[model samples]
Structures are given as C-alpha cells and as structure tokens.
Target: MDFTAILGAWIAVGLTLFILSFLYRDNPLFKIAENLYIGIAIGYIFSITIYNVWIPKIYQPVSNRVFTSLSNWVPWVSKFVTPAGDAGSLTPLFPAIIGISLLTRIFPKISWISRYGFAFIVGYGAGLAIPATVATMFIAQIEGTIQPVFKLASGGAIDLSGPALWTSFSAILLCLGVIVTLFYFFFSLEHGKISKKVTKIGIYFLMVYFGAAFGTTVMGRFALLYGRFFDLYTYRTSGYYHATPILILLVLIFFFVYFGKSRKTSP
Candidate 1:
C-alpha cells in the first residue's frame, strides 16, 4: 500500500483498539479515543452544516442572484435555481444577522445579543416541529393502527380466506395495545381493580417493546463489530493491507499502556 493508505490503516487500528479497551476499563487510551471521536464528530458536523445548509441556501443565492443561463460555462442548474433579483440577496440577510448575533456570546458584554438568535431559533423550531410532530407521531400512528390488513388474491379479489385472518388478528392486537397503552397513560381514570389488570397488560406490551428495542440495539452494535472484523480479514488478504497485524499490535500496546497507567494511579 501507499504510505498514506498504510498510515491511515495504522491509525484506524489504533483508534479502534483504543475504543475497545474500554470494555476492560476506562483508561487514558479510551479517553483519548473518546475525545478524538468527539472532536472529529464536531468538525464533521460543522463542515456539513456549512456546506449543506449555509453555503448554497444562505451564501450563493444571496451573493449572485442573477437569473439562470443554461448555455453559460456554468452548469444549467444555475438557471432554474439562482434567485431572480436583489430580493434573493435581501432574503438571506435576516437569518445571517441572527446567526452572526449568536457569535456575540463569545463577548460577555454583548452576550445578550445571542438571546435574540436563540429565541428566533427556538420559535422557528417550535413552529416547524408542532405540525410535523402532530402529523408523524399522532395522526400517522392512528392511521397505522387503523390501516386495512387484507391481501389481494390471484384474481385481484380480497383474500379473506387464509392470510387475511392472521393479518386481521395482528391488526386487532396492535389496536388493542395502542388503546390499552393510552388508557395506562390516562391519569384521570383511577386505577381500580379492572383498570389495574388492563394497565398490567399495557405494561407487558411496553416491556416487550423495550426488550425488542434493546435487542435490536445490541444486534446493531454487533453488526458494527462484524464490519470491523470483515474489514480486517478482507483487506488483510488483499496483500497491500496490514490491518489485522496492526490491530493486534495496537491491542497489545493499549493493554500495556492501560495496565501501566492503572498501576501508577492506583492508591
């Protein structure tokens, strides 16, 4: 492999071993990996926010509002998307001003200016979220609960004969679960004898949900582990790759460092 590729592989192996060392104990290696991950994540997010959200939407349109000219050296996309007039430039000023105001927090005296930006962000976010949340969390969920559950037959007829029975049963269970869960959350109804039994059933459903979610998360993490091993094996056989050896070396190095640090810091 080229020097850069080999170096990257070594770094990746070191970082992975450092992160995995936490399974034994949290040590300097793990802390270093954790901080590095956080730093990289923040930088990645900031770059994406600037490129994806700020540049095209806030900067380009405002900077050059000229109409699209497809035949120009620039891509034809500019004609349709570029703002029509000076209004395009003016459009970005308000949000840009608010965004700049947010930076005032760095200066204690002018930090109050940041509140305006915060308030604007909060108000806009709430305004946007309310309708989206209602539609997605409430209306869509209710619609899903009541969704029809029959299949079409070979003749394009509703197949109520066989599979529909199972489908209908599952739908009925979902609807009942939703109803019972809602009732469980309804504080107005006193938890009397019958209500207690019903709420118990609701709790059972919730437990099953929580268990399934936890299992799925565990499986997802395992999948990531599988991916790392797959990379190690796949690339190791590629002749140019040395990830597996590097990984083993890092594992040894991390364990030694971690043990030495532990002994040094031990009371």
Candidate 2:
C-alpha cells in the first residue's frame, strides 16, 4: 500500500482503540483523545467557514458587486468616506471588517457592534430550525407512528382491511399513551382519581416502550463491538502482523490504564 493509505489505516486503528478505552473506564488517555478530537473538529469548522462563508458570501460579493455598483455609492460615502473597489476583486478586507465587528465583544469600547451579527445569526438560525422541526422531524415521526401494518398482495386477491383497522387502533392507543404519560410529568398539582388511573396506565406503556428502545440500543452497540472483534480475528488468521499485534497491545494498554485509574480513585 501507498504511504498515505497506510498512514490513514493506522490513524483509523488508533482512533478505534481510543474509543474502545471508554469500555474499560475513563482516564487521562481517553480525555486526551476526546479533547484532541474536539480541537481538530473546531479547527476544521473554522477553516471551512473562512473558505465557504467569509470568502464567497461576504467578501467576494461585497468587494466585486457592492463596490462598483453606482446605486451604493451615495450610501457607501455616507457610512464611511474610504474609497471602494481599491481592494482586489476577491479581497479579504470585507471578511476582516466583519471579523473585527465580531471581535468587538473583546473590547469594552465597541462591544455593542457585536450584537448586530449575533442578532442576525440567531434570527436566521431560529427561522431555519422552526420549519425543519415541523416539516422533517414532527411530521415524519407522526407518519412513522401511523403507518399501515399489513403487507399488500401481488394479485389483489386477498382483502387486508381488517389488519389495517387493527394497526390504526394500536397506533391511536400508542399515541394516547405517550401523550398521557407526558402530561403526568407536566404539573405539580395532585392528580385526581381518573387522572391518576390514566397516568398509571400510561406509565406501564411508557416503560414497555423504553425497555424496547434500550434493548435496541444495546443490540446496536454490541453489533459494533462484535464487528471490531471480527476484524481483529480475521487479521490474525490472515497472518497480518501489524493489525494483530497492534490490536492486542491496544487492548492491554487500555485495560492497564483504565484499571490503574480506577484503583487510584477507589476508596
């Protein structure tokens, strides 16, 4: 394999080992890995924002279009007397201006200037989130819960109407159960006799639902762990010296560090 590909594979193995450390116990090694991951992610986001948002949306558009346009000349003069269009076509000055405005919060003299950008960002984010929550999340969940349970026949010979009715009735009950259960936690007032009874029934259904969800989550995690173990076993069988030795060493190191930390912390 090429050096780059080999390096990438090694990094992937290291990351997997770091994540597996959590199965043993929390320690300095896991904390370092987690913090490094967060730092790298933040740096990546900053780089992307500089390239995508600052350059294309704010800088380029403002420098190329807004400067040369005759309509903006009067307002531009009134705002600031500095000559426009002197900077290059893709000048970084506009981004610098906005960045300065954003940094105003660090200085007491111009803290109020940062509020403009913050308000714009907050308003736009809220506007986008509301529609997405309603259309994608809320409606999709309702559709999933209310879906027909029966399978259709190819020849159109058999009637599936009864199964559909049963499915609808079950869905209605499930919806009511969830709603009542949610309402049970909504208030401090003492629940009346009927409310108490309904809430008690709701709790039973909720517990069943939660138990199923927990089972599914556990199964998914176990499946991932099994896959990793399978990879290690397969590599060993194939006589891959690097993968087998590294996997063994990683497990041993993780266990040692985890147990060492646990011993130190335990009373």
Give each model's whole-structure lDDT.
Answer: 0.80, 0.70
lDDT of candidate model 1 versus the reference = 0.80
Candidate 1 wrongly placed segments (more than 4 Å): 50-88, 106-108, 147-160, 257-267
| Residues 1-267 of candidate 1: C-alpha lDDT, one tens digit per residue | 577877676677777778877888878878999999999999999999999989878877765543433324477766466554443454777899999999999999999999999999999999999999999999998999996766777999888775687888898899999988887898986799999999999999999999999999999999999987776666564453667676677677868876988799999
| Candidate 2 per-residue C-alpha lDDT over 69-135 given as tens digits, one digit per residue, 9 for 90 to 100 | 5336556543553434443353456446655687889999889998887776678889999999998
Pairs clashing within candidate 2? none
Minimal lDDT window, size 10, model 1: 64-73
Task: Work out the TM-score per prediction.
Answer: 0.75, 0.61
Error of 2 at 196 (Å): 0.7
lDDT of 2 at 158: 43
Q: How many residue pairs clash in each candidate?
A: 1, 0
